[model samples]
Target chain A: MPTDHIMKTYDDELKRLNNAIIRMGGLAESQVAASIQATVKRDSELAHEVVEQDAQVDALEAEVEALAMRLLALRQPMARDLREIVSSLKIASDLERICDYAANVAKRSIALNQAPVAKPVYAIPRMGKLAQALIKDVLDAYVQGDADKAMHVWLSDEELDELYTSLFRELLTYMMEDPRSITAGTHLLFMAKNIERIGDHATNIAETIYYLIHGTPLKEARPKRDRSSTSVVLPGPVAVATTDSEETK
Target chain B: MPTDHIMKTYDDELKRLNNAIIRMGGLAESQVAASIQATVKRDSELAHEVVEQDAQVDALEAEVEALAMRLLALRQPMARDLREIVSSLKIASDLERICDYAANVAKRSIALNQAPVAKPVYAIPRMGKLAQALIKDVLDAYVQGDADKAMHVWLSDEELDELYTSLFRELLTYMMEDPRSITAGTHLLFMAKNIERIGDHATNIAETIYYLIHGTPLKEARPKRDRSSTSVVLPGPVAVATTDSEETK
Candidate 1:
């Protein structure tokens, strides 16, 4: 075959991979949306659908990997082609994880339905909406190769983080106030965490998009705002707490 | 250059990539170990060291990625060589995440030192040791191409998951019994969760090694035993709770 013919065929294969990524992203976004709906509505059926649908995302990721490996071996993609192909693998993995977290949230929603739903459970959908938007924007950024849009998604994740921290405190305080609510509150905490992690994966995809477009890593430190890792909520009427102490210094 | 001479240089380059992965694995293992030590001893300095050392793991992962991409483009490796190179990208990414989780554990440890230590904090080091061993064994499996050894690491992760679930219950129960311990218990919960995630990444590396050596994906459902997400521990004198409800059914 002529080199021109081979090159054109390789370009087509790359396009196929790109389309597969977009499809995978669509599945992930719906999974996140449906999972959050399941939690808020206490719809076990929708949650079950989300959990079962994760297999499709995993299968798509496997397909992307096989196609990528074949392209690397046969076409020997270099420079821009190589970066795009490599970024696809990383991006697919991140999407797979985002779907996994969505499924996890769905799983916890089923558990949450066992007890009286806590008041804070409503906050899950609000956070979920933000995460879903980030996934959508990041996927758009990925498909269009828009670094600025991807950067916007990256910066927007701080809001989700802030929301998660407030929810974390609320759930703990709720659990303490009504010991019976502890069961539901714990599940909600994990569900919220799953959504927060989905946001993080969106940020990761943004970084991958930035790298793919610029051929260089985004150099600025990420604007991370999740302080829940060190957060402490004391159980009392005063409810006063220290976020950190000198021992950490 | 002769084809034979070019093949020799490619072989050397592959060896260099292999060495870098091993070095990256070593750093991740130590980070897990030191981060656990920091938590057990409440040593802020040691925790700080683990946090600082994560950058080396990050740098080494970047080096592996660059080398893998170079080999894929320049060598145009086929069959086993292609699989090995591709697997390095995945394995390095998993190791990098293991280090990130380790750093997270270290960060939580520093925060934990600020408050009264919970009795359940001691379970963290136990879980950490299991996770560290898994990392070491999986690294050896990757380097030696020992699928059986990798499978061992894969199965042993169940034990870590089981341990984490028990710790999750213990911490929640402890917090309920003494409301004053809630702050410390929350930090300990995250630390244990981080260690459990480290174990998960080790399992991920083991799966990559299995595929690399066998040329077939491991089709069996992993013996996953972490039920903490659905776990609901009620607060009462009897301290009894249901793990799940019919809504999941």
Candidate 2:
């Protein structure tokens, strides 16, 4: 009876840890959504709210860390339990980073508001929506212990990357065509990059969830389609001409 | 004698874990330096090499993770050993990310070489050198268990951020002035941001080391001076004149 009681208590603690991560994930999801809305609306107050809410995510991470450490030290959990605990820590860290990137998008949105919104600025909310979906799906995967769902999120990151690459080119063209848009364009570019990175953190969480359920890291190389790192958009007449063609399309 | 022998073996495993982190740290340092060299010298071959070396860092991270998990399960390490083990996992993850940023810089460098070099490119090596030093000093702090030294690296991040802010403004002005430079300037902008992020990972490692040694998180607010997020440089006369004043100075 005593052992059964202790086992129940351990289960409760583990559930508490899981709930903390889920709560943290919810905060991250909201922050990303709010930041994107703020960027699109040019609403500084909403941006500030996103920034303020990030502290809560950070606090949740600290709380999860403490509880995880205590469980590891006291419970001496083994096998699946140990993996679950470790994955929780990793997942929390990724969620914390996701929130940070969202806050960064908000910060840039504040600066971006100073200038007239660039045409490419509209691409952000689309990208933001994709990243938000990924976060939501990955958290659901975590909650359900659904490796298939997690794997789906992992593979879907490629679409986000492709979207980002196209947006990168568009932003560069917009900036070069109207030098006036450079300030806004650059801020929007970084904001897009930040959202792209949030998609990445969601991929990271998906991987952690897969590992937690399967006990092995995803072996194949993750599909990395974010060629924006190596992307080049030439300036002057050529870039402007390209934009002109696109506009006709 | 049996307990003593087990204790000695446990000590050996911990030492090996520490050495693996040090080795991993060395790889990260080399990747950053080589990437920077490639960027400054426009050496595509060296950049390729930096990209190739990133896999080794990734492999080491997996190895560290495996070993840490094994130790936790078998050793049931408590208190300081547990903290050290956990910190190793965290530090390895940071180093892995540092290498990823370095690889990204390399990737961007390859693209950057396609265009004629931008003048702002010269500042990359300065930033790179600073990031390289922070990595080196932070690793030494980890090795020596020197919290004070770790704090030093932690604080030095502000200088790197300040440098990045100036480089950012300069790059934006250059791009607006000559659209031809936009291609190279954007690449350089990303490369500089990559190096700045490397500095951030060093600060993360320093914090991990501090926690490992002191068993308490640094309570003070980390001084963050990277205002480039909200930084804006308008296009046209205002920005050009700002550059002109700086040129005279």
Candidate 3:
């Protein structure tokens, strides 16, 4: 075959690999949305369906990995092509994690369904929607090689974090107000956390896309506002000591 | 230079890369240990030290990535060598995450230190020890290319999960017994979760090492016994209906 023909064939393979990534991303987004719906409607069947659907995402991840490896070995792609292939591997892994988080949400939804509805479940589903949208936008950016769109998705994760903080507080209140709510409230808390993590994974993909396009990672610190229990406040100069006796009381 | 000289140089570079990984892994393990000590002892200075130490891990990760990319682009290693370089990239990422989890734990320890001890903190320290050990063992496996040792680290994560479940139950009990405990209990819960996640990352490294040596993923499913709120029991053929009204009350 002529060199031009070989190059054309390589380009086609790259295009097919890109399509596979987008398909996996779409499946991941659907899993997140379906899991949230199952949680809100207390529909165990929908949750089960979401769990079953995760196998497709897993399979796609394997396919993307194999194809990317083949491209690397056969084509010996350099610079931009190298970045694209590597990013595909990284993005597929991130998508798989997102799918796992969604499946986790589905599992939690089933557990929550068995228990009483502890508190009004509004914020978690909102966070889920935000996470799902972020996944869509990032995958679009991946397809278009649009760094701007990827940055937007990356910056928007703070909203999901804020929503997670509020939900964390509300769940704690519910569990505190009525001890009977503890079991179900805990499940909701984990589900909310799963959604928040899904948002993080979406941002991860955005970073990968940005790197693929720009040949450099986003330099700024990730925009983060998760004020949950793990949110770290850097200590002031000297550790301010509170009276231990007063705290124990 | 002869082909033998070029091969020698490549081997040396690979050795340097492996050393960097082990160094990063050690820093991560120390960070985890310090964070746990700070939490248990309520030593804010120790926590601050752990937080500050994370920068080294981050720098090491960047170095590892550069070296791995250089090897990939210049050497174009194939088969096992390719897997080794690729797995180094992945293991470095996981170590970075483990370091972040440790830093998060330290930050939470500072936050929790301001409040009275919510409950006896026995289980969390034990879980931290287990997580730290897993990090150490997995990294050792990486250095020795010991798949069996890596598998041991991977299988041992279930113990961490079980410990986390018991700690979750204990913390919930403390919060329910005293509303004032909620503040501290929440922080402890997050710390426990951070430790649990560190263990998960260690398992991720184990998986990578297993893949690196065997050229195939471990066939068995990851052993998981996290009976936390997220653990799901699939519904039977017939949905077992509970008295929802009683649960609400």
Candidate 4:
């Protein structure tokens, strides 16, 4: 009877830990979606609400961390069980960062409201939608222990990167054409970057999910198309002037 | 005798875990410094070397994760011991990210080398120096389990933020003044942001160290002065024209 009771207690604690992560994930998804809506509509009130809602995500992260630590000490879970608890800690950290990026988008929306519209705000909203979808899909994957769903989310991040790169070039063009647009354009650029980073966090979660189920790190290289600046590999040294025109594009 | 043997084995594993993190921290610090050197000197070979060195950091992270999980499952350490193992995992993750950012700076250096010089690259190197110093100090704090040193590193991130904000404005001015400089200016902006993020990861380490030693979070809000767009708080709707000039400055 005592053995059965201890087993039941362990199962209950595990369920609670999973539920905490689910709640945190839901909060993060809503915060990100609302922040994007606030930016696109220039609704400062909505933006303020997104900023205020971030506190809940932060608190939930703390709760998840505490619970995971307690499980580690008390249960001494082995193999897959250990992976599940540790991965929860990692996912919670990623979710918190996603919430932070959402808050950044909200804050930038306010500053963007103060400036004249630089360009039609189409791409950033698209990127945000993609990022939010990835977050949701990865969380569902976590619940089901579905590595296939997580892999799908991981592969789709390249699309977000492609969108970001094109938007980046367009923003630069706007700023260059009209010096007056620099202020608004810069804020828009940051918003796009924030969404891009959220996409990265989603990828991190997907990778974590894969590790949890498989008991091994994802061995494949992450599909990446972020060719903005950092990923560009150069050939042998050539005259700087010759490459200037090619780079300016 | 059996209990003594088990305790000794546990202590030895903990020492190994600490050593792994210290090694990873040292590698991350060197990578950051080398990438910055590669950027300032426009040395493609050195930049390539930094990129290659990242594999070692990634391997070290995996090793640390494995060791931590082993310790948790085998020892079921209570209280402070549990915190120490979990904190090592978190610190190792942070260190890996810091190394990734350093690799990013190196990648950008190759791209920036192909373009004509945008502005004298003074501020970014200085920012890199500050970030490198923070990484070193936080690692020392981790080794000593000194909460005070960790807190000091946590507070000093504000200086990096101030420098980043000033650098941000200067980059915008350069891009606006000359359309031709946009490509190079954009790359430099990313490098600066990368350094700023390294500072953030350093602060993350500080927080983790504090939690490990003190058994509680650093309850004080992190000191922040990053007033570039995302940190700005908006007042009630004012004349758009009135805010435009202020924003440009």
Worst 10 residues of 3 chain B by lDDT: B240-249
Colliding residue pairs in candidate 3: none
Error of 1 at B102 (Å): 1.0
Worst 10 residues of 4 chain B by lDDT: B240-249
Ranking by TM-score: 2, 1, 4, 3
Backbone collisions counted per model: 0, 0, 0, 0
lDDT of 4 by residue, A118-221 (tens): 57477778999999999999999999999999999999988988888777777666665666666677778778988988989998999999999998898777
lDDT per residue for candidate 1 within A103-147, as digits (tens), equals: 889988887887776799889989999999999999999878899
List per-prediction Cα lDDT, in the order shown: 0.85, 0.86, 0.78, 0.82
The TM-score of predicted model 2 comes to 0.95
Model 2, docking class: acceptable
Residues B1-249 of candidate 3 have per-residue lDDT tens digits of: 699999999999999899999899989888999989998998999988887887788789879977887787788888888888888888998998898888878877877876667564777789988999999999889988999999999999989987887677667666666655665677777778789889989998999899899987665667676656443222223222222211000
- Interface root-mean-square deviation for each candidate? 5.0, 8.8, 10.4, 8.4
What DockQ, between 0 and 1, does each candidate earn? 0.44, 0.44, 0.29, 0.39
lDDT of 1 at A97: 95
Any residue pairs clashing in model 1, and if so which? none
Tell me the spans in candidate 1 whose CA falls farther than 4 Å from its real position: A1-5, A237-249, B1-5, B237-249
User: What docking class should model 3 receive?
Assistant: acceptable
Model 3, residue B112: C-alpha shift (Å): 1.5
Q: Quick one: ranking by lDDT, best first?
A: 2, 1, 4, 3
lDDT score at residue A153, model 2, on the 0-100 scale: 98
